[model samples]
Target: MTPISSKGRTRGGLAALICGALAAGGLAAAGTTALTPQAAHASSHREAPLISGTPQYDNTDLYAFVSPDRPDTTTIVADWIPFEEPAGGPNFYPFAEDAQYDLHIDNNGDAHGELLFRYTFKTHVRNKHTFLYNTGPVDSLDDPDLNVTQTYDIELIRLKNQHVMSKTKIADDVPVAPSNVGKASMPDYGKLRDQAVHQLPNGAVTFAGQADDPFFLDLRVFDLLYGGNLSEVGNDTLKGYNVNSIALQVPTHLLTESAHQPVVGIWSTTQRRTAHGSYAQVSRLGNPLVNEVVNPQKDKDTFNASSPWQDARFLKNVTNPELPRLIESIYKIKAPAEPRNDLVDVFLKGVPGLNQPPHVTPAEELRLNTSVKPSMHPKRLGVLDGDTAGFPNGRRLTDDVVDAALQVVEGELVGSKNDLGDAVDANDKEFGHTFPYLAEPTEGSRGPLAKGTSGGTDVRSQLGDALQPAGESRNTTLIAASAASGAAGVLLIGTGLAWWRRRVRRPY
Candidate 1:
């Protein structure tokens, strides 16, 4: 994306430049936390030391947007359990039974959630006598063969200034989409996903299940900030990985203060059950990279636990960001002057006349103005590309947030205009067009290249090559082959988790 040139307007003072910059297209950048060895990995994926160890309770990315197909509704997607290897099984990933996943809406710009959607999951195991996850080929969510399953309950809670005024169970016993085990087991995975989607009594649609990790970016920046020469770029780090996702689509009027006030702030949090049986908020995500790149080590965990209204302590991170300064030191590009109030406004509050609500509380949130209709031809760079319908208006599945945020972090807003990007522009997989828009989770059958079948081999052929020995009878070898595959998958999981922990522990 090219920079917005100064053709009609003169480069006046910083204030004028800020106003002009915000008016044309708002800044999508926000203050970031300490860069870990896993820096630039999927936004908010394993961002903190404590949360990194608890993937199921970790908040990966949050997306909120006016539904492109049905403009009358807004879709909010929050992902957890980052980097889920499709093959990691026996006991595949499941929503933490003891945790409470919540989606919060600040409709009045008060930085406090006026409404919250709390999701609690329960696991079901029909055949404890067998080691199999499924007894036979599964065709539907309620298929008898599916021995292990999960169901969740959704509670709609109304609060005034954080104190709950009302709580109602909107959905109960909603089936969660099971993991896409290989084709033989879950022959029609798509059908299972469709069955998992549930319609709530409040005219809302909800889905909870495994989906492809939609966040894409060049995560190799951890290697001395792109090999310290921009050499390590363009690779989508999150490709092939899956995440457990919770998607909700609610009527537009329900999220806003009123028809007149369409702007609303959105965020998600994961609360784990403590030893005392009290649920404690362990993970929170709003904007894509706020906790990943803005907060320091000392404050990363604190940021996760704190509420939006109590964000005053982290204000310095926004006003005087470290990312630009690091870029300046490494690349010799001059950093923007200190005290970046423009960042504070756009990221914490929202862009005025765009998505910013009147009487904003200046807290970090994915603020969306439902009044702005969906774009027919969405620009990946989002608002920076003059497509106000995308982020930072509210993040869309297709928004190139890494590029837009990079450009802004390099001082695009304060007149140092240029394009800076991670080069990885879009998600490796195409997102769905329906209610739960995330792409289907990668199936467990995927395997690495073998000696002869290396080029463009289809998955079925690969599976056959992996399972059937030369001239071996199908029935005789299938059981042994499947056992071997399961063992390999378990080994893969162990190695992957160890590698990830090492990376997470590395100092920035």
Candidate 2:
């Protein structure tokens, strides 16, 4: 794990980065308010009506960034099964045997994967008679008494100009690390986490097992979209949760076709084998919070079922998005004009100067510039605050994407400023600065978690309050520094009040 050092990032960047480190270290922070449901996050975590039925195969989050340690390599992480309680005993979470898990990469901007990494898991129970996951203590991954064990195979396929050119098996019969049941069952979880990190057949590194849910958000965004005050972020609902993660560190040459264009698009998909032999796409994730909040209900299932190239049908949602409209109506602030090309530039196609490839079709996928040297002092409000090495390019674990995303939707990239946001700038857990950056999963017999509001206020709040409420006595304290935030406060209350008035009708 990369050591936590001074990273002179944007205003509140250093603090958020520390939060990420704490999240990775299994730390916690408590607040007066309760941990609401994680309202703000990326990808589809039971977002679709159909995928919601299958949690194991659902892609909860996807993260890809240039390896900070190895500049020549890039690490891609895809997580599944949202909000998994650590204490889920007996039949713990495991990758679906019948499902095909794949990491898709597109180098030329065609929205087609030029290279694909596939994984298929198999479960083995040594002793069917034993009800315990382990008959005794699990000192090692290969413990004989370990009743149930899960393993997988790694297959890499490369396509040049839309035709498969080569296929190779990087590994076979790789054993997965056992779950962190408790102190009695698995005393040393660090060993399990380390043993799970295996060297791939092709020289790449990979790890597949349970880990802490790194994605953090103040769920208070639910009840009313804009009611909660931004002073203190609510508890991280995902702090005590875990997720099934697939982390891979591979070379850049495997993804790109030419050295001229260093940009590549990434996305993950889950497929279930059909009787016909081919796999049917079930779940997909590229960018964070896309299906969760961007798309409407009627189109969510379709978005998950379709491929990136098929995203054209949903382009209407991007050009004139509904989210901005909600922000405008509720915040009572002006949003970017219709035919919002600014959004299309960021959401669909990668920003031209930052991550867009020289020649490519506009599509929805996480675009990363492999050329950008990983920044140690990465900012949470990526791109918005001049931190080009962070998100909106390729998301890093420490990136404060929630705030960045909010600022982007409010036209921050185009120079419009709206600092109002969920005060939760940092994640509940710390993030590692290396491969398999996620922190350890909450143990089954995990001790009671600790919480603290020891950190200072998030920058968005401080910036909004930079100019203290005018001394002049007025009905409403006008925050001159951040006029938008003052109006945002009123708008949020009004929206919450309006919802109360319409109690008779079901709110969408």
Candidate 3:
């Protein structure tokens, strides 16, 4: 059996990651789903029709990794609300008071959340009958001028037999960071962000706020689906979009059952109160683009409400994905055959000895091996580029899942590098490289001149060094430029070991 070594990581043979796992029957682990391949970039945006109508409960993205800044702890960031326009006045984004946000971990590989982190919100309209979100310049998160404010309660629950065995509210009535309307209302947005950070008794750090969207991708790929060619200039559609984010950082011991099995599966979900007062799940996401690309139109909603244990039904989608065929349609290349064992290994069971749990039972999740040390110089292309700490091992804010997923979808392990890409490489704002790493949201209403505003551009832009060739030792690529209104930054980096790209007939 080909051990699921980082063999493909050193070369462009990512398909081997699957090939090896297939030999081991990695997909037999169970509770796995067929996900979207080479089709889209963003992970879980408005994936289903119902979620499209309810942005508040929609989970846009989920990132879990060893905290680069604090390797002793792990960071799991789940973003809600999509494509928020900073200038949207009156009522900016807030965690839906009636909704329940949750992060699930399956460390023991039961395809169930052995531990669950739940967040519930409550909003207070301090200034009733006021049209302004803020009556005056909001000097701080607690400023009286900020009329609409929200507070959240966080709970860490232990689950057994799909029931909560114990639930502890880690933090209660923690105030949410007010939205960054603009310089006029928020003089120092960073201070507001700092004020929102809540320290819990259990040694956990949590933050909930409106922040710049860190998901980077050219969203225009969905325009044609399998019919047309992607526009050469499909810019990163998510640029400038802000989101409601919940970031939690906890010690490694809190996430894992024992040091012997440090690998864990991660997923985020949202539930809303129905008229009957019962909560109903509206969205769920683990890996990127699974719901958006894998589930058929009719089943997208079903997939959202389904559980990891019931994911076997969707296995056909992965074993027989159409994403490669779609790429082949435009490029006239030979696509992989049925039972794409490679994808099953990567998306379902995870790479063995890497992110795969010791006794995993096959589930769709973003798996991370807690034992892996945070890399000093990470590669965005992830395992494909030979980075131990990148995506498929546990994703970081900097992991280019879009590019990695695209290559894996094309059967890179089988020596197929369709070289499909969105061309949008990096994020618009600078990631903090610390807790709640996503950059601050773009200014909307304007108060004090915020830092790093050179012609409305931030000095530490996430997209600053993207789309460039991957270094033999370190790689980078230009994924996106600065947002027009917010921080207009640029990025440059590329996938590992670039090969000759053969552009087929331009379908566009």
By TM-score, how accurate is candidate 2? 0.78
Tens-digit per-residue lDDT, 1-508, candidate 3: 0011222345633445555756776354442433322221126777789889989998999999998878889999999988899888878888898888989888887677899999999999886887888999888777898898999998889997579899987889999998888887787899999999888776789999998899987776666642264444336678778999999999999889898888888888888899999998778888888888777776788777776756776777777877778767766657877677677678877786677776566668888988889888877777777677888887888887877787777777655654556665577677997788889998885323354344655333443444335552222222233333243223212221222122233343
Report the C-alpha lDDT of model 2 over 1-508, residue by residue, as the tens digit.
0111224534443223323433453221111011221111237667789889989999998989888888788899999998788778898888899998999899888677889999989999998886788888888888886778899998898976558989988879887876678777888887878888998744589999998988887655554454522333445656788999999999877777677788999999889988998888888888988887787888787777777766766666666778777766655668877665566667666765678776556667899988888886776777656677788788888776676777667665454645645656677778776678888888887643312243332334334323335774221222332244444664455455455757846766
Candidate 2 Cα errors over 4 Å, as ranges:
1-42, 160-163, 226-233, 275-277, 447-508
The lDDT per prediction is 0.81, 0.73, 0.75
**Candidate 3 weakest ten by summed lDDT:** 492-501
Selected candidate, larger TM-score, 1 vs 2: 1
- Choose the strongest candidate by lDDT: 1
Full ranking by lDDT: 1, 3, 2
Clashes of each: 7, 17, 49
Stretch of 10 with least lDDT, candidate 2? 30-39
Please identify model 1 stretches exceeding 4 Å from their true place.
1-42, 449-508
